[model samples]
Target: MSKKPFFLSIILFTIFLFLKGNLLAEETVKITLLYTNDIHGRMYPYENSIIAPETEKIGGFEYLSTLVHKEKQENPGRVILFDGGDIAQGTLYSNLTYGISMIDLMNKTGYDFSVIGNHDFDWGKEKLGHMISKAHFTFLSSNLVTKEQGEFIAGTRPYALKNIEDIRIGIIGLACTDTTVFGPESNISNYYIFSGEETLKFYIPILKEIHKADLIIVLSHLGYEEDVKLVSKVPGIDIIIGAHTHKVIEKPVLKDKTIIVQAGNYLAYLGKLEIEIDKSTKKIINHKGELITILNSQIEPDKEVKYILDKYREKYEAFGDTIIGETSTVLTKIPYKECTLGNLIADSIKITAGVDIGLINSGGLRDNIPVGPVTMEKIYRVYPFENMLISLDLSGKDIMEIIEQSFSGFHAILQVSGLKVKYDSSKPKNQRVIEIMVNNKPLDPKKIYRVATADFLALGGDGYNGFKKGKNLQNVMLIRDAIIKYFQEHSPVSGKIEGRLENSGKEK
Candidate 1:
């Protein structure tokens, strides 16, 4: 052949090889991200009444572990497991052990990382530090800063970088700023929380520019609305695993190429997000996500996790199994309205503290009491905060102000005893309380009355700032203990809503 033809052949061969290599590099890579949020220390399967009406056993660490392991077996190295936070401080197991049991379970189940939640600070800073030290997985939160030192909280990373099959995944964590207001105030008083948007703005560019991260994920303890806002404002995030609202997102929400997923509370569901990325461009070409219900009958329990859970159950069986009381009426929690269970709890506080009025935030009532029987375990699930009751001497004016503030926000509605309140939510805030009565008489501005409320309120949690002006502050007893005592004395108790709170407005 001629020299020109030979040269042309060599060039053609080089171009062919280059194009073939580019095709191979552009091939899509599939990654599966399995996540859980707001587990709240559910180590064993139990019937969750909130998720379903029937008494079918639902979520547990064992079932979650089985699902995770099976996913890993199917997908191999492409599977990554994570938790969204609120792992501690829900069940008797977590409360009794101070979160160690949950941490061990997370370790056994092979969690890659988790974010910090407000409830994780319930036991105090030192205990939170202890739990962080014990956790085998990394904890991430980019926005939490110390007050005195102006540094990130110890034992937490701002972000994490993981490499799987030539994919550089950057995971950033953001915690809720409400921790200072809703958590143990003293424990978090030394820290200041920054906004998630600011943190993302600072970190996303760094992850993309310096770290060369192919994909960015956020583990956020911010609620659903906040997560939606974050994705709308920030441009680089690919996925957000959200918690703190206890929302059951049946399907992942996608906005502007970002996916948000939350698996409700108490391990009722497991969230999974799968994405096929164009390796060359580091962009997701296709993705799908779903919330998988952790039904015990559908998924077999992991033997090792079940064994560990049994050990903890055996240790706390006596306290958890004790009969607290029985209720003739179903004490259900009605959000944004007066609930029968809330009435019972408020009544318990009034009787225990010998106060003229009892006030408790509705958010403190977490679960409904079944009519047939009640146990310490059931009560703990209802009132899991472990809040102590405090007796406060407040003038009728201050009490009225507190009630008005509660009516300002739907979630802040106060459960009450020894008093009646009628509000028109259509009216402007700070003026929503239409009428207030104490002991069947109009509230007197000057007269002082004894008020019993949780210490959380006395410290001005949930925007009950009027409680701060309370005088003669006295610690009465643990609110849970007081309720337990009331149940012991009032077995087969009748908890009913007798129109103590009436919304007279046209708006429902």
Candidate 2:
């Protein structure tokens, strides 16, 4: 009997010690989120100085893979890798292969979840569907809805839940509404994009009332400003990882209880977010954001990824090197002003569309075609936006108004073909077009005229709202395809300086 009492006492004391130790220990959980956005299909580091002279060779998938591996080593099982969006377009490789290479690279990198960017629809919904089906991670886009099956579309989720030890995190996604306005017709023609705020309002209750997630994260393709608007309107969001505008943020900007961060375009920077959450409440107690530059000199790429990249490179080089045509002089892209190359592209469009005049936005010109014998590569280098050639029939009065509105906010130099105009820079806004002509004939306000321009400018974007009001708009073909056809029909096109400027009325 005495031995039984002693044994019971020992058991009680052991239980007491165990409970006391656990109370004192109070283990803390820490998680690190590593992210990239606007990785514009740059599978390899930039090479060929003539093509990309100003920027250093950097941001290859090989280097990114190596960095991810190193970060994993440093944090063991507590690290998560993610991409915001825009992984589909912007390079020859992306354009040639229709985003397959980027999809393959992203799958290899093991992205946990991503939102659908506007460019993701470049190859249309079918290709995007295939990529989503093939992706190893979840693709989330809440605002995208479908009526095909009277339900949501394929390859998209409103949100994804991640459980790291005892902490529960809910990551939601929002794509930009402008995708409907600016994206290719095939991608978003059938869909309706709802306001991000409205979508979040419905989901916030679900996440909080039902799922009980500890932290809420938003994966948004909406630009930084839109994300800021989202934070201000929606309550309970903890963090937002943004893309679209390609704004490189060095640190997280706090708005009330929410934090916003964006890594710049072209995979040039990786955003690392380190967070400490309270064990009981699961709310963030501490957070830090760091933007890591993917500089060539600083990073040594992983050999495995490099080898795989080499294999893709070998396959791409064969088709990419095919000779097409030659350029007599260099064609460059200067965003603030019209360049000679910009004029050439606009001229080609005007000629192809059989329009009276042509205009192209400076932002549409992606790169410079170095002065030399032009090739297929050179054409691809100069006009990389892949915008379609849209011809619109406008009265001379409408054309003049467009020109005036274009020069409203900033100095917009028009690259013209088959047109002549004189401007006074000192003139007030919308009155700068001092003189206008069509094919050496003065413009008649009542006379109808045809004009050719890219689809991007026609939508009132790039500060060209005058185009949206124009009539008889017709989209004939893609800009690059038109250029290619132009060269094929009229080989050896000689450079022409169509002096459209005739009179300068009191220069600024």
Candidate 3:
């Protein structure tokens, strides 16, 4: 054998080894991300001894802990936990405990980061600030900023970068733009809410340039559609975990290179994503995702989280046990296509306002009233949202527009008081509102009218986004306060279902 041939063979073997080693070094790292949203401070299962009508209780901090632990165990060291937000208010417990309990629970549950939700600011900016300070995980928000008792306004951080297993992931938080409309005056009246798209535009370049993260993830409370729109306006976002629409997305919706996932509401589901990244090339190789249902039969509750939850449970019962009034007849809330309870409550607001008509968004009705003795507990359950009563002097044309918008869609099923409206559902959009009358009087299109409605509607609830554009807006009263006041004045009472619904110009 020639020595030249032997040398050539050695060189070929050495080159093969070098190329193989480079390929092995470029291998991707696997990361599993778990997400939840709109927990609404449900520390314990919905199975409270105080409230009746038994349904399978699914979510609680304890159960959530158990589920998250299982997820971690499944993925071992490659898991990341996140909550999209709304850990502030909703139930009797959050309202009574002032959100410290929930914060403690979130810290205990190992949430790595959470975006500031609209409800997080429900208790006001000071309280929200305190919650952020107390939280163990980073409270990531890119849009909300504080006015330092001066004229200057600053936007929140652009995004946060997390380095896990050689992969750099940037997480940005986007608060809902409807903060001005949904949140209380005290929480956001001073600080303005900028467009989510604008904030993202300002941040994306900075994150890419400064952080040099391989991937960008947006922790958004801007609802799914808004997130979809955002990805189109701003390029380069890899994933968007969204909330505020309460949509239980089974699969992540990918739009223009942005993958969006929302874990529904009330802690009923978890969003999961697995991403494989090439460390050497600094690129995402593959991604997989799914939504896991948190059913009662699936997992056991964590004892420590349960213990903390039990303490709040006791506190909740104590607060709700207060006797507000008695009902001679049962006032129950039935989850119908159109709710009778909603009609009654909305009528209460209209009566309180002494207005010609009143409307309440059915979405604002949180819980139900059982068919028995009425207590503060019952009232709280029936009308859970802390909504205020807002009045508007809308012209006849504005009222028609509002009605047309509501009736033409799945959302416009009216829970009204002191008015009868008849509309054709089959008519073209916005033309469906056929006839509207206040006290047997046909609606005057040119005349100004006083209307009472829940604050949620004033800010556009259930696709009625036009309410924000309504003229002469005035917060005449709060819906909850008005209801409480009505109970105080009326004492023990019962109400008959008035003829609120009537046939319009057409048949269904």
- Of 2 and 3, which scores higher on TM-score? 2
Q: Estimate each model's TM-score.
A: 0.93, 0.82, 0.80
Pull out the clashing pairs in model 3.
388-479, 389-478, 389-479, 406-412
Per-residue lDDT value at 169 in model 2:
88
TM-score of predicted structure 2: 0.82
Best by lDDT: 1
Model 2 lDDT at residue 418: 72
All candidates: CA RMSD (Å): 5.0, 6.9, 6.3
Q: Please give, for residues 1-508, the per-residue lDDT of candidate 1 as tens digits.
A: 4799999999999999999988875597889999998887777787866565575789899999999999999989999898888888887888899899999899999999999988888888788889999999999988888889898768999999998887899999998877424554336667777899999999999999999998999999998999999988888999998998888888888887898888888888888989999877878888888888888888878999988899999999889999978999888887688889889999999999998999998888877887877888888888888788999899989998999988787455889999988899889988989889998999999999999999998888876778999999999889999999999998889878788999888644
Cα lDDT for residue 263, candidate 1:
85
* Candidate 3 lDDT for residue 445: 86
Sorted by lDDT (best first), the order is 1, 2, 3
Minimal lDDT window, size 10, model 1: 179-188
- For all candidates in order, the CA lDDT equals 0.87, 0.77, 0.74
lDDT string for model 3 (1-508, tens) is 5799999999999999999988875587878989999887666666532322356666777888888898888878778888888875776677666688988898888888888787776766667767877888887777766565632212234467788877788898887777433554335656657788888888888888888878888999888888888888888889898888888888877786678888887777778988888878877677888887666656887998888888877867866777766656645453323355667677778889888788876656766655455566556545656677887777777877877666664553557776677766566777766678877898898988888887667776655766666667777666877777776777566656665555444544
Best-fitting candidate, measured by TM-score? 1
